[model samples]
Target: MRLRRALLVSCAALALAASALAQGWLDRVPPEIHGEVPARAPAGEPLTVRFSASEPVAYTLAYGGETWEAVVQNLFVLRVRPGEHALVVTATDGAGNETRVAYTVTGVGAPAAELHVTERARAGDPVSVRVTLPEPPAEVVSVRLGGEALPTFAADAVEGGAGRSVVALGAVPLSAAGTLDVEVVVRDPFGRERTLKRALEVAAEARPVQELGLTPEALGALSDENREAEAAALREAYRGAAPDPLWREPFILPTEGVNTSAFGLPRRYAVSGAVSFHQGADIAAPQGTPIVATNDGVVLLTGFYPIKGGLTVIDHGGGVSSLYFHQAVMVVTPGQRVRRGERIGEVGSTGLATGPHLHWEMRVNAVPTDPLAWVGRLLP
Candidate 1:
């Protein structure tokens, strides 16, 4: 009996020791928090705050008189009004240990914006205006050059950098010379607005004149109604542009051919003695020669028209577009995405052409600009 009693006592002692060891192994330290949050955030916009803890934890965040609870592994987002805010966060571990942190965040007003443009530009030259802001804007209201609205799109802050800026594109008309005003208006996330303005000096350059002979039948084929219809269709296409830039590299020549006519040249029809300025560069090539897209873009329009023949227009984003006219056949359809140098059509004299050729044109906000100037360089 005594031996059994001693054995029971020894078993009781071993159980107590195991219980003590288990209690000593329980976690007791609170999680250590680490990460960063923006000292200043845009008013009325969601601001992402990121942080991590040394161990698994559930946290409650308090900001702008509101509280949010979550099992956060990395980050959280909150919106604050225009003013200073005190952000407090409390973390709890599985062992019931707690860690608390506090931070001060300032909600800023409308962001300041600046306009970038060249002080001087030449007639018929493509003009690009860049607007830089401290933060991404809610919307770009308007970009105007000489009282005319331009095509605007979102662009990278710098080449090969993060996209955080807006770019406006237009051309100085052939008749425009002297000083021109540039204006830009933008809205912030909180509905706040800001405006920027600048000036550009335009210079005129003389162009050569050429005479062309066309038969009366060919000249009278297109009526005034047909011409107006085509013009209206083109205007609609130019007004709707993709919100972002599509091309990463500089534009390329659409085809390999001999240049027969230059852009912005005065052309007088010999049969009727009617005068008009050439809007595109004419390249004489053999019929069935392959034509390629100048840059990456979405096909905006492709159809046969009274004046353009088998035409294809590609929207290169940023209010920039390229046109290929007088093609024998168009291979791409509207809404199709095309890459740079991809074949889009074949060269031919389909519309009002004296010979087989391709008429290449580039427009900034529907204003004709020099296509050759964009061939090898990135426009500002």
Candidate 2:
């Protein structure tokens, strides 16, 4: 209720309310108390109660052992569990006379909910979250990422594992690297919920949303001239990662070689004097050596691009993708499904490359991850 009331004289001694009524405020027509109790809803559906009176009055609302009084009439949204609920509304007029009303509603059942997701991610990466409940199915209420609310349409549920598991899935884009926090609200048919809390350490720069207290280095870091264009392309590429994981086993090295360039290596470009972080692991391999798909996935992109020459991207689903760059030749075409260890390209020095090498990278939400970390293990 948004009741902003003004201070007024008591006028109790004058019996002002009685006199005003005697003056015939309601003589021509009876006063009206308008609005209705919302109909019953299935668990997880929203519950709202709205009311209004023809004239200004004091109103009190009672539900679940709690009573609320307001100076003006308004709407109320209740976040209670499913079942039958009674609502009591009391209104008092200027004359000190009062009226009380009651309403009841039934709510359906929903599945129990608990959050399942990774605990760490970088900015520009995707944060995948799931609500897991028992087979019967439950409705999702709300989802929040980094304290921002996402629209309800963002959630999708899949019933699997012999109807023993119901998984509600959703994700939010993370552009501010550092800490990733997520919350999910799920309700059962009877209005019960299991809340999930997730926190992940993002292997990225700290982007302070509030600038007032930012350090000079932090400010300089956020002022990236290439941020706009790069962010857009990365976001589009990351879209492929939102689906369920398609890979059946751990990732494999694209070529028979050792890592020569480790991920997260900071470097200064001798030509541009620009500083940036290396996003992938470079494996030293002879030119024309076969490069394979790390896991099962559909080739999302192939062919040349700036920085990453002979580029090929495979979306492995589960918000994860693998990138092979600096290849001598790209044999895979866009949109082709490939299997693990399938040769998709040949190793080469391409796109700002210094020598013949395979620059292999893994991304989750388009955020660069440790390629080796996924070599033989399913992602958490």
Candidate 3:
């Protein structure tokens, strides 16, 4: 009986020993970490490091005298000074098995400058192009869209004020329907020249056509000399733009009236069979309706003309200008500062028109755009 009892005890001990050995083997396998640390990063900028483990793990990251602990699923972000750094990570699994990883990261200066532009725009729409650099450039040599120079101004950078931003305003031509190339040339503070390039895709816009009949007096006013003179005056008014924006709020409508003629409409005169696209919107109102300034700006020009009648041109700065035409009386004069919604004129049919109305127009960098788009909104 004693021998049989001893044999049972020995068998039980062997079974317990086998179970212990199996558990030890399973605990020896540590969790595997999967990820890569960037060898180089932008100096002083936040660098994000993402990693995962084969199994759930508690991870600890050590660098630059700082320690961070979280689950392996969470990402690690660090901002290292402009130099080399040693990053060490330790991961521990549920079974007490641990794994360690180390990486060497180098922090470098800012990357090459970049140019940003609107990727897509509709024909006759305004587009904004921007150039970003680590430091402000000494001079912006030129900003060109489709090989034409554009007016540029300084603006706040998009990257949390870490760099400088130069902005240029442009418009897609009413007839353009393809990709347009943009080029920017700037001189760095060190006097080194840098050129950046980008492309903008312009979509076609289909505008409606309108036919109208004009009296002999109106037809006579549309002479070649009158048109050329009006064109020259407008060019001179838009030649010098303020380096900054003057409007402090959203733009408003110049007057309240029915929109008789929309912008970009092909107007065909029945009297002479002449066609021309309307550069502005015609708002029909009673004679002597109050007209207000679209935004805060300086009155650049106010005078009577053959085509525009009592016209007032306001420079809202930053390549934006507003025009109010066909007015019976002009309340503002050149070099006078006007505020948004302030009275500037009275509606009339003094110009080449069939009835009393106000022809309101808005231009960006000398390019006529849809004025209604600017109403109730602020632009860059």
lDDT of each: 0.82, 0.65, 0.80
Q: Give the TM-score of candidate 3.
A: 0.66
User: For model 1, where is the 10-residue window of minimal lDDT?
Assistant: 20-29
**Going through the candidates in order, what is the number of backbone clashes in each?**
0, 14, 0
Each candidate's TM vs. the true structure?
0.66, 0.55, 0.66
- Global lDDT of model 2: 0.65
lDDT of 1 at 276: 84
- For model 2, what is the error of residue 359's alpha carbon versus the real structure, in angstroms, after optimal superposition? 1.5
Q: What lDDT would candidate 1 get against the real structure?
A: 0.82
Point to the candidate with the largest lDDT. 1
For residues 268-337, could you state the per-residue lDDT of candidate 3 as single tens digits?
Answer: 8664587788888889999999999999999988888998898999999888899998899999898899
Q: Report the lDDT tens digits of candidate 2 across residue range 1-380.
A: 22322223444524676675677443333235665776466645566777888766677888756678754657777665477777788776665556677877655565555676755554443455655556445667776777765433222222223433323223333344656667777766556775676775667553222112333443343444434544556567666553666766767888987677676555554423455666788898999999999999998877665456678889877557888888989898877899999989999987657679998888864557667656776443
| Clash-forming residue pairs, model 1 | none
Pairs of colliding residues, candidate 3: none
In terms of TM-score, which candidate is stronger, 1 or 2?
A: 1
